[model samples]
Target: MRASTPAYTMSRPMSESVAAIVNDDIISTYDLAQRMRLLIATTGIQPTQENLPEFQQQALLSLIDEHLELQELKRVEKDQKFPIILNDQEVRDEITDMASNNKMTADQLLASLKSQGIAEDTLFQQIRASRSWEHWISGRYGSRLRIGEDQIQATKARLVAAASKPQYDVSEVFIDAGRAGGMDAANKGAAQLVAQLQQGAPFAAVARQFSSSSTAAAGGDAGWISPGEMPPQVDTALEQLRPGQLSQPIPVKDGVYIIYLRDKRAGAGQTLVSLKQAAIALPADAPAADVEAARTKLIAVRSQIKDCATLEATVRNTPGVIAGDLGEAETSDLLPEFAEAAKTLQPGQLSQPIRTKVGLHVLAVCGKRAAGAAQIDHDQIENRLKGQQLSMISRRALRDLHSTATIEQR
Candidate 1:
């Protein structure tokens, strides 16, 4: 037989100091504040007065989810003889790992956290909650998990392809313009979020608070993605970044997206290039006169262009024209349309006006280079696939738990 759940209660008229009530647990303003501190200490995102309210709001939602996780663990363990507890060494190691990420020693991290009035107990408790949730999942479903040879081989092939091409580990802050509001309201909200993000607010924290996507729960991490997987706008944005770059807010059909390029693969089978480009904006609905004007400008300059340096200087004299000195980049990273046209250009040769999502671009080849076959690692690929599978399984289990649980927020 199952233990009885606590009775539901009305939310008290909320104050700025009060966070939320989770079943019988009172997640107070103090808890929220401490959690925010923990978030910064672990993730290295500094807090600000401007982004504080939204950060707290996001923290509160996480607390609510944590509560759900805890509640489910408790219900499942009612028949257990002992409460769940994590090893102290594991907790310490986690803290050490987090400190290393922030370029601090474990003692320094502890001192810094203490200086900010945050306690080690807070992190310890969080670890325990997460571990308990993991335990619950393992007990319920771990027995069913198996990694077959076919899955490993498929993952290996994908990784080889990734190493051959370009891939990114990206984190996003997505605003669901479709349901949150119309595009006008969406863009405004997205712009506000982007501003806050630029002002030192952590991308993950903001995503958990504000994003409507499922990935928001994990701080809007979009994991490893190939080129075509992203929306057209996002894919375009990705092309313009290196690892650790933060992109401006991009409006797509459904929502506004802001991304941090956490990482990318760089190795063999890579074709790198440097190019100079002259471009004119041909808006999707541009008048014929404007199109012809840009066309005339591109053609007139085509013969005069010599090296990339000459084209860049000359494009300055032409009105409504912009030139690019795209320093060495992977050929795969180039805009798809530009990459094909660029492939045909010899050193010191110019391309005809190439149609891109942005506009018409005429390119000059500065230089190009390519690396040999990729150095692939089948073991790492297998591990990544396993991790991905486990993550999906964990999410599915949590969704099941949430669907059956009784939750109300203030």
Candidate 2:
């Protein structure tokens, strides 16, 4: 029973201007402006002339949703003769936590907002609506929700099987096209978000405030996703990104996405090893005497290379010897000599000096993880399933309210 986009008209307005009407209530121009400012301030999204219109649209949409949620909750409470109390203390507590995260006191935060010309009530009302809606959702639906043992087992099995694939630690921000009014708006919004992220905006904060994905509640953390698990476009994007980089806006059927890669690793079940190499570079056809000298030089320093940390310094101190970091890699992926050496040594152990076509090399095993070692526990899987269910329920309920409500935008 979802309705189409609520009819809207474009126009300029002063502080006292009416921006939208919802049921029997109104959202004023001042409210929309302050909310937009708050979004930028809390989320660290830079405000620019090019993106101001997108910001306004996002802010207005958020306000409309909040109005719908609050109004529905009030109606349910009154009709069912139940109490749905969200007091100032609760809002204050949230503010305190938020301020503490930003390394500011509540008073200081309010003062800072005041300096920005945002009224304190604007922040409070937003928090109140969010908390109230969460309470109502949990209370109304918590008991009815269930996760079967089979479901948990299936999820665990799937995760364990997928552990053999490469995984990326990722966070995302999704802009739903339907909510944004069309594909163009959604893409523009996603591009705007990407611009802000590239300019040093905090990704987690921005995701919490703006992403429409279910993971938005967890600041868009998707946590160790493997290839083939995500959409083809997303998989392609992740493949092109290195650790600590963001993807450009990727348009999909439902919306657009911006992803941040925190880290990536080889297949979890592979024999992962961290190594450092000390080598004396030599020609393939070097004289036997020259090769012997290189071997002697490496041998002399081999005992001195007690650990990975000191390997470089030891090499630097010894003339004609060079140091290299093999970094972390799967043993099978390493060169044959390096792989064989890695397989035989434990962490902190050094291999005997070995000769190769390029040089005489000494390898130190900094660390190792045995094959088939990845794990995701039962509790974590259960919680993820429950969260997904709750998110779906919340979305469906809200969509119903939107369809049944009276709304007009100006």
Tell me the TM-score of each prediction against the true structure: 0.54, 0.71
Superposed on all Cα atoms, the candidates' RMSDs to the truth, in angstroms, are: 18.1, 14.4
What tens digits encode model 1's per-residue C-alpha lDDT throughout 186-295? Answer: 67767767776677777886775567655665788978776665688998899899998889889898788888999876545665567888889887777778777888
Candidate 1, superposed: residue stretches over 4 Å from native: 1-18, 40-49, 80-83, 87-90, 100-107, 135-143, 158-225, 229-233, 242-244, 249-258, 262-374
Q: Which ten residues in a row have the lowest lDDT in candidate 1?
A: 1-10
Alpha carbon deviation, residue 172, candidate 1 (Å) = 5.7
In the range 1-410, model 2's lDDT, one tens digit per residue, is: 21122132123344378899999889998789889988888888778899899889989999999999988877787899766747767777888988898899988998888777777787888887877887788888877888897887677556545667778999998888878889998988888889888999999999988888889877899988777666789999998999999999999888898999999987765677889999988878989999888888888899777778888998999988899998988889988878899877766789888778888899998866545554556677788888878877887887798889999999
True-structure Cα RMSD, model 1: 18.1
lDDT of 1: 0.69
Clashes of each: 0, 0
